[model samples]
Target: MSKTNLDIQLKTIPESAGVYQYYDKEGNIIYVGKAKNLKKRVSSYFTKTHDSGKTRVLVKRIADIKFIVVETETDALLLENNLIKKHKPRYNVLLKDDKSYPWICIKKERFPRVFPTRRLIKDGSEYFGPYTSMKTVHTLLDLIKGLYQLRTCNYDLAEDKIEDGKYKVCLEYHLGNCQGPCEGYQTEEDYQENIKAIREIIKGNFKDSLGQFKQQMKDYAEKMQFEDAQRIKEKIEVLENYQAKSTIINPRISNVDVFSIVSDESFGYINFLQISYGSIIRSHTLEIKKKLDETDKELLELAIVEIRERFNSKSKEIYVPFKVNIGEEIKVTVPQLGDKKHILDLSLRNAKYYRMERFKQIKITDPDRHANRIMAQMKADLRLSEEPRHIECFDNSNIQGTNPVAACVVFKNGKPSKKDYRHFNIKTVEGPDDFASMEEVVFRRYKRLLEEEQPLPQLIIIDGGKGQLSSALKSLDLLGLRGKIAIIGIAKRLEELFYPNDPIPLYLDKKSETLKIIQQLRNEAHRFGIEHHRNRRSKNALNSALDTIPGIGEKTIVELLKKFKSTKRIANAKLDELEEVVGVSRASKIYNHYHKE
Candidate 1:
């Protein structure tokens, strides 16, 4: 890690985009980083002489340098994350063991309940999170289940199984905690309504929802069902406690997302703060290990894009830690004090939690294993000529197929290259047709591939059954790009596998290792596509609201948002606070119309 040697390496390095490796003499990878300009970033380690000799020692041990040029920094990030995960380099301050953090698990039964658990099994149940805090997860589970009276039973109790006199209600039921659907004490509709209440509760409407819960408690009390009333009353109390916490954060929110990023040499963390209604409802952090030797500001920039990729724009107004290239009036700032500081602190705490809970774990299996094996399986099962070195997976996501977009994630050597990940907004298809959407994404992806002079992948994976695979293949054939990338289909549930010309293999008992890899690709694709759609959707919604405000020019809207966290908060703020915000009108036109006070 000597400065002189690093300078020498930088001197010989070409100013081109590529993946780079820092290796010790034993040829062990000390760190893996990607860069748009390898010579510039890599050589910085050597050229910048430091006070301490810590890096110098490691730099001296550098026996070799490895690199692969790529088209974009995004591709560089992808490759770096993949390499870091696969190799588990020594010099990287690795978030070693963490993966997806704990989420509150609600079992879907006749009673329909919510419980907190770390495991994500592909059962019939719905998962509401990839939450960062175990404490928050448990608190949320308790809040949702206790307040809603959603059952947490493990038994298959039928409607006729329990009679009020035949059996005493369980502790939860007697405490007015369970909805008591097991004894026909409540209908499915009532239980379902409870689920909606939980959703609204999580959305920061605890006070409003609390009022509604209290009415339910009153109804049960008036019916002379003191027991049920007591249960509902407890739920109201949980809601009240949460509401009290909300008071710590002032109101002025519609829907919005906030993000920040911090990085070191080998790993980085991005904090996501999600707000709705008027409260600081929830936040999350993504422990991103891949980057191109990101500077502090670069981390902040990626924070916006990363969170924006994950959230829909219609439901959110994003606040960033630094100015980003998000075009238009997206609010960006570096907080010094006030309510914004409170939110920023929350985001940072979440990032630390994720660093501990999710990012710290080392993945034993190289993600590239799936690609290597799937490629081998292709040779064995589909008679392919060779193992697929470059594996690509595509998936489309949108509600009612609106805002349809497809994500393409590239895998090389049993690992994902985030830098190589690409997204396609479904342009040609309308409505909820998966097949057509598949056709659109595939056609667009390969068309660009044909135009570009980069190496093409050997395999293509579509997130569907035969129909989707056929559509993609059709598009490829039309582009005269057949056989260039092997195409296959992966269907969920019985976890089926299908090749373009072969019959679908339903739930073939793929080994946990094999199943795990494909699932990762599909999940990443889903995550990437949905995030883009949501951020766009939320941004669009915010823009529409901005249009509705009077006497607020575009620059004024940006200034208002930059001044206040969200437009709704601006509307709710005192005139003095609004005026203090940068570029607010002295005439107070904005405060006059928007401020509720």
Candidate 2:
């Protein structure tokens, strides 16, 4: 544990490519790393100056060392990644709770039962997915069921068992969902043909099944069996539809592993997209917690090795955004353009989106920290003097200058406070004047809050550009609150955020959490305003519709609506039905009004 002991221990390390682990006094692995020469790499920690502050701290805590020598650098890289994942060392890029996703398995048995499972037993079973979504697995299984009559029972229909009549055809066979392989009614060779087609379909190659269906259709048509031909044509259409939905990239870019990474200060997200016959067969993103200030290249290399080994990838080449030292067995390409670059970009987008989703999940799980981070980000991004903990957004909605309304949505601690949301019917603004409507709503909302001596929002978002923002600012000025609260307007056209007296709008990254929160505010206010306006329009329509009936009064209309439940039901009611409800005289007038020839 002493410096002299550490120096003495380093002398025993091998001078070969291998994985090394550094341990603390507690005998727990503090770091896992791969090096070409273990002796030199392990000794360099004590011998050289480290620019990284984390490295210095890690070296100070190292009390012991362990190494695993491998034949090649690639093996070392792989072993290092695996050890890091399994042991979850304190100083390595590790994905937390990283469980293998589900795969659709076709058990290599008699009748070959197809189902979705997480386990991958190497018993000659054909596994398809390792899919990112269980829904995808269920979808493929459902599609297979719709296409072919495969057995679902777990009966062991060996040749001897079938010959001895050990099993009977069940309800599945009677329902035509299974081909009764248990009774030997379906020959093994014939059943194997269906299994072959299914294997191709699950592998993202639908051409074989489609071709066979087309051939079957042609044969039926030639024999003048038009119904059978039509059925086969329908089968071909289903295959084509599924194929069109799943296919995304060029078919020529096949059997390649594509990986992209996006990292922030504390964490890195690595997205892996597996392409087979031009379709993305597997798409997954991994979240890595950085123990040190690791570079993107380091994180990416570690992830690629871990992912490929976990997925059992046999890809001879990998498409990456930059070069990685993964060794000579698999080629790593940094594609500049074309489909290769496009695929890489797609993978990057997945990583970005995954990072965003993880951030959201974290916000839900750790509200206090997430709120602190978001408020800090907002303060920095918006150039506000303080964190806008309680924020409000306003939107105006009016269709064809009728029933103009406004909505005020509140966000408390980076989340919507639905109970505090307010809706305004534009009484002061006669027409569809959004600027005037915005001014009226803003004046009404804040004036009441100030009168009641209630807390006010730190930031206010206007759902339009300069005009609406200027209108809201006037209201704040009238309330002696101008410059007291931060206000901005977001233009619908380009998501440009406009500030008071600032001509050049500030453009935040479209994927930023701050932008997403602002967008959420805008959308919520718009939806609330639209809903309020629709309710007004519906009430007005009902009032005007009943007013047109000469003999029917407001009370009668209400009673009729209450009984009939809707205007359409009232319109469709018989003369006698209306009479039974509202008396003969009023019912005849209402019936005549509706049934005018």
The best candidate in terms of TM-score: 2
Give Cα distance to truth, residue 478, candidate 1, Å. Answer: 92
Q: Put down candidate 1 lDDT per residue, 235-349, tens digits, no spaces.
A: 6776777777764455665466777665534457888777666566556566654433445555555445544443323442566666554434455556677776677677776
Model 2 RMSD vs true structure: 11.6
Clashes of 1: 45
lDDT of 2 by residue, 253-365 (tens): 88899999997656789999999888888898888777777889989998888788677788999999899989898988999999899999999999998988887898789
- TM-score of candidate 2 relative to the true fold: 0.64
lDDT of each: 0.68, 0.89
RMSD of each: 28.9, 11.6
**TM-score for each candidate, following the candidate numbering:** 0.44, 0.64
